[model samples]
Target: MIASPDDVLDALDPEQRQVAEAVDGAVCVLAGAGTGKTRAITHRIAYGVLTGAMQPTQTLAVTFTARAAGEMRGRLRDLGVPGVQARTFHAAALRQLHYFWPKVFAGPPPQLVETKIALVRDAVQHCRLRADRTELRDITSEIEWSKATQTAPDDYPRALLEAGRKPPREAAEIAHVYAAYEKIKSGQGRMDFEDVLLLTIGLLDDRPEVREAVQAQYRHFTVDEYQDVNPLQQRLLDLWADRARSLCVVGDASQTIYSFTGATPAYLLGFRRRHPGARLVELVRDYRSTPQVVGLANRLLAHATGEAAKHRLELISQRGEGPDPRFVEHSDEQAEAESTAKQIRKLIDDGVRPAEIAVLFRTNSQSESYEQALADQSVAYLLKGAERFFERPEVRQAMGFLRAHAISSGSDPEPAHLPAEVRAVLGNTGWSAEPPAGSGQAREKWESVAALLRLAEEFAVKWPDATLRDFTVELAERANAQHAPTVEGVTLASLHAAKGLEWDAVFLVGLNEGMMPIAYADTAAKIEEERRLLYVGVTRAREHLTLSWALSRTPGGRGRNPSRFLDGLRGTGSARPDAFRSPGAGRGPDGTVRPRRKVGPVRCRVCAKALQDAAERKIGRCLDCPSDVDAYLFEQLHQWRLERATEHSQPAFVIFTDATLTAIAEVRPLNERQLAAIPGVSRTKLERFGDDVLALCAGHELAIESDPDEFEGVPEPEIVPDGA
Candidate 1:
């Protein structure tokens, strides 16, 4: 039996009780992260059914994703309220379209295309334009955005300018592609996911009978994730509640991360203006995370600007205190990944299940190193909301496409525009110099193509005459070697994919300046959205949270700074001497630290000029300085380092970072005193390799081979927890 109104109301928090009690007319629930919005809304529906205010069959609950809709249905069932319809906007609209198609104009509903990729690809071919897989996805997204906003193909260009949309391609080009896509879709007697919503709206608008039936059938309406409702969804909702505006919407503008999909928080924010008597309730009591996590989330939003942040709710944690979020700075991307994997292993060993942990990043491209690092540590991991790089359809297709082009070229001399030629060949699959402007699948696809292009560039640089055929072979080898995703393991996901989900622990990796706010987050509005994105990541953790960034992308690359969003968040203290816990942290021999000292900018030892590059800082010299590096000594050190790395089964850089190796070669350390003076040559490393290194510098070889087992019993570095 359904719970009574009093019984339902008694179970809700004060604000949630207000949300459940205001069961008539229009209502708006300003729910913050971790708040019990789901509980409040489900109880409201049950209370209404129990009090004879609404019928079960007539109530409809709509959300963004199928998983969310299913969750809502499950929650409603647990509340003793069954028979109420719960579905995603697409599912509900598709069902209504099928039911009303015969009544309106068609013999039967047009066959719905499962995905827009094929159709969009066909449209690109029809328009005689070149697009790679990424471009095709971007075009598909643009069409969806256009249809959701009710903008016609002819007006897409103006719409883009008006809305400040930076599409992957030119607005005019996208419009042509959009127009061609519609024509082809119509010619094949097929409709897309977006068309389902558009056609349903058309049926309701054109046929009053159909509109009345739907409106009368669904009298009480509730919307979840209302902040993510696009114009098309709002139109459908309006049609469903035409005369009787018995509606309830739950959303947090702070969680609005789908603007790329044309979703807007305007409707949720303006609900009071639309319905003057709408009951407004603010659910600030967060039931998911502890006070520490909640406080960080609130602080993240406090720095946010723009309209969405204007109405941000300050979440109060209902749970007890938890560990403060930690921030770690690493030497490079590889170090960051390894450190993250080690921590995940520690968490699992400490009783946290693998599935209870997640590692989130800004882009899918960053997942590779983490995947490798986790595997290296023997920790299982699953890719959430993404596919393994090699297994992606776009990547597989591009490989085939490139191989075909390479065969067709057949013995031609190297073209001067090798990079351009490679781009042209991949353009058929959507390769471009610039990346996609939007997030999600389009961005992920673009990153994949960009990686291929980067490989081609590197190959061309290495062998000036290397042909397309050679590059294809290299790619095949990589694809064959790429690891398959794990079935059940630690979750690796993009921040966008982590929404509506929580974990016992979360590691937010790759928080560098160009990434978190993203390099293309040019405008103030977009930057604010990036801040909100970080906020979303922060709130996903229920207990343990660690945020980290690397100083460089590769072993030998120049330094990169942490994200500005973390300016006031990370700890500022003297560097720790520990090296084993995190390999390249602090002023130890293994890595350099950004210490708080009275020293001026590092100067070149030779020129006495200020040195800016990280590599130069490590060597204490400018790049243009006269040659002090011994070529033979450097080669010997490199060989020795490689052998050590092989013996240890670790990356060469892990044994000695590129900068450290270069510094050693330049200094040509003769003994313990000289070797100890070099940066990145830790005491432990001196004890381990000092004698061998000195002998090599003194032109002696093939002596004193040490066993790898001799290095056993060395303590691993502890993952230092940080506080602001």
Candidate 2:
């Protein structure tokens, strides 16, 4: 049955209704996470079609992901408005490009480049520049960054320098490779993903007829996640509208965490500037998380500083009270992981389904320990963004080959020759000692197969009586279980993948300083993005939220500190119950009160000067006043120096002497211009580490001012580099 317009309007709350009913001209809906932004936009399309203000075929609903687009289409279908076009920006643009290619370009469009990294590797070889994996990753990142910023290859170096970004390799080298990459791609009659949007925009802008046709066909446009729209996307959006202002965009600036991808909230933040008469609506009511969770999210954002932070919408929680967020500290990463798995088990025992519990971490690498811990406890768990061990294609294929071999043999193979048998099986199945040329996926698949062989070797050693048949049976059972979609298991996911997802109980693991903000998040903007990511994780809890960290990776190692983000949450006005106490509450067997672990700013080991930079604190000394240098900071500087050495493929200390870092730390220059004045701080170093050095010093200073008592007993050291 076709639902009436009233039926569509009735589904939304007051704020959403206001947005859904606004069917004309430019409308911008600032929808927060879990605010039913999807419902608002879907309902808006339905209302438009029902009210004769928009035809389903004339409206284009653009989303960022295919999953989101499918959901939008499904919701529109449910609303009796199935014909509305809902697709990703790429999908929409690709469709138009495909349709108009022969007419506009007078030939078939170039094939889309599916494997960019391979092409980039070729570009590097063509440019005669040697690059390692890290450098290659960074160069590709630079290319993406350049494309996202709408900077052409010829202009990349200037734009990169102006932005004060330190490329992993020489800017000129990267630029040369970028230009070569473009040339090679063009020569091969191919286009990368970014070229789709760029080409579509160019076609629309240069050809009036094409623009008019598109504008005429899609007269009304609705964009989801507008805050993440890059400049290229924004230009395409503008061209699609053809200056008619029949565009509605929905996004939450606070959720704008894709800056790394060249997505800026600038477009969303400046929407009103472009359309002064645009109707604005804010969806602040959050229906996903509990009030406690909502309060925590609000507190987290209260510390954010950016354009997105400036326009932050405080979410009004729609649900009743739930458990206060918990903070737990552990002795090390292993203890943290084991304890987390235990907590999941406890939550499951307490009536919460295993599927309703999640263990979220900052990075994908952090999942390994947790997976092991869960497996040790025999807890069934799914790694959300990772392929299951038994489900990997390589693993499955190897298992199939093993099973067939075992069946053909009609007997158990001797454990002594199992290693050879496994190798022979893999070799027969086209496995190679070296990765195939220009195919990363093939290399990864080979690695997966190699891993399975290693597992088999280990299994053979662990169980001397085991046969190939035994291993095959075990593998079959595991694969079947792992491949089941609805298996009852806890979820382990990275924070990035946890966005737009919620759970009844969430354990946010690995909240340590270097892990949370990450060692590489060295700038204010990067830090803010990290904060937003944490906020997204915090808001994913419906009933319970547990924030946790560990002191170190192992026992008796240098202690890792909790994230600075925790300080903001602790200082917030919100009141909540604590489930765990900070470490160092009691003494050893002597029954004495343990000396309180120094909980304050780091002091330079040399002069005992308080060091604010967490890295500096870790190093335990200042650069010049090496009496008490922050060892970690020194190590980090050394590592960065080594990376620079590798970029030139030269020896370390040749790029920049240790004394140079000392001078930099002593001078504590606040910017590249200032840093360049110091001796040994060469033009290359200035270009490479200038922004990083300044950020480090600034972070330390801020930390000191925020909590001076932590620096008690430490004398204030003068900031003066040797030459300065």
- Say which candidate scores most in lDDT: 1
Candidate 1 lDDT over residue span 37-97, tens digit each:
9999999998888888889999999998899889888988877888898999889999998
Task: Kindly list the per-residue Cα lDDT of model 2 for residues 300-418, writing each as its tens digit.
Answer: 89889977799999999898888778777776565677677767766876899878999998766566566655543445677987676665656777888998987786453234366
The alpha-carbon deviation from the true structure for residue 446 of candidate 2, after best TM-score superposition, in angstroms, is 20
Taking all chains together, each candidate's TM-score versus the true structure is 0.74, 0.68
What TM value does model 2 have? Answer: 0.68
What does each candidate score in C-alpha RMSD?
10.9, 22.7
Give the top-scoring candidate (TM-score). 1
User: Which residues of candidate 2, in runs, are more than 4 Å off?
Assistant: 132-134, 387-488, 571-724
Off by over 4 Å in 1: 1-3, 393-443, 449-485, 572-581, 584-586, 589-724
